[model samples]
Target: MALILHDVTFEMVPTEVRLLTAMTPAGFPSPAQDDMEEPIDLASWLIDHPAASYVMRVSGHSMVGAGVADGDMVVVSRAVEARSGDIVVALVHGDRTMKRLRRRGDRMWLVPEAEGLPAIIVDEDVEIWGVVVALARRYRT
Candidate 1:
């Protein structure tokens, strides 16, 4: 199976697909009383929420422009709506990548967070697995 966002579809190799599903968020949260500042555990919320969850570690600088760098763990939710210019995870040529989603009319482009990676124009076959919701990175001292 592949990831589909809108009309764009991102296909991955079987190994990558397994990796994507295997790496999950750390915790699942229970519900809390209203008006409380307690946060909802994303892992658990995803059970009822339409989005799928994955915790992926950044391994390149291509997305440093988006504050995602090597060693950063991104919390990606597949259920969120992917709008134009949103950061997303996509598979390009059997490889998974994190990039900004930019749509132009019926055409779309994947903008890399890392400098120098050429912008990729996507066809209908491009799969957009999900929108990135939050990023957790370790700061280097």
Candidate 2:
């Protein structure tokens, strides 16, 4: 299936909570919150460049090693500069794909996290849409 960009605009919801000071352990229960400071807007915290940022639903597992699993909604920012080692949504040969950006001298490549998958060598026509900033996925019940 082809990748689609679903344009989204955020209406700031001032939702804040006391973030726990202690890390919850998987093996056992941990102590309660000792302290937390300031109210934080989760949407603002996640997407710094609000005007140029958007979200998309991921459908592939090629980026699983990068913690971007299938069925996850990834936040992307067009204003955020795309650098080497940054996970980006790009257009390769007219096909939109999500991969890790890698630059070697003057050449660019899109690498997949899966061991058996092959890397995509970017041609002159490639267009980088944006850099992936955050990912959201719901746990199965």
Candidate 3:
């Protein structure tokens, strides 16, 4: 049998945290679909913070090139800033999805990598949920 390995790290910091009001489905605009996902148990899957955090299983093949395939779990950092080349969770027309971010003329656009897909143009109706900080994928036989 072949052994599979992953890197591990540790960081220490203060316990206090600043809070941000979460934007809900009602607040999402220009979404592709209205689907609410079932939340996952964080402790068993990821590192837990004392403050509030949520996890969503990624769906769709739009981000397949980036390795964020359908049913992969992406860890979103609500605390991180969205940069030009970072992957993000966004609400478009009330639909939540994972996408890569890019800057346009004073605006940001969400680009999907799956072939035969059109980019979700971000407008006044779109909201960036959070920046995708980590991704975990499991191989299957």
**Per-residue lDDT of candidate 3, residues 34-105 (tens digit):** 344444443434534423334556656667787776666666767767898898878778767677898877
TM-score of 2: 0.78
TM-score list, all predictions? 0.60, 0.78, 0.59
**Candidate 2 residue-wise lDDT, 1-141, digit = tens:** 233445455666668865655555564435554467466777778777777888788876667788987788888999878999999999888878888999978988998777877788878778988999887778885
CA lDDT, every model vs. true structure: 0.63, 0.78, 0.63
lDDT of each residue in 1-83, candidate 1, tens digit only: 12232222222222211112322255434333223444445434323332366666666566767776667766677777888
Candidate 1 segments exceeding 4 Å error: 1-51
**Top candidate (TM-score):** 2
lDDT against true structure, model 1 = 0.63
* Candidate 3 TM-score, C-alpha based: 0.59
Ranking by lDDT: 2, 3, 1
Worst 10 residues of 3 by lDDT: 1-10
What is the alpha-carbon lDDT of model 3 when measured against the actual structure? Answer: 0.63
Give each model's clash number: 10, 0, 6
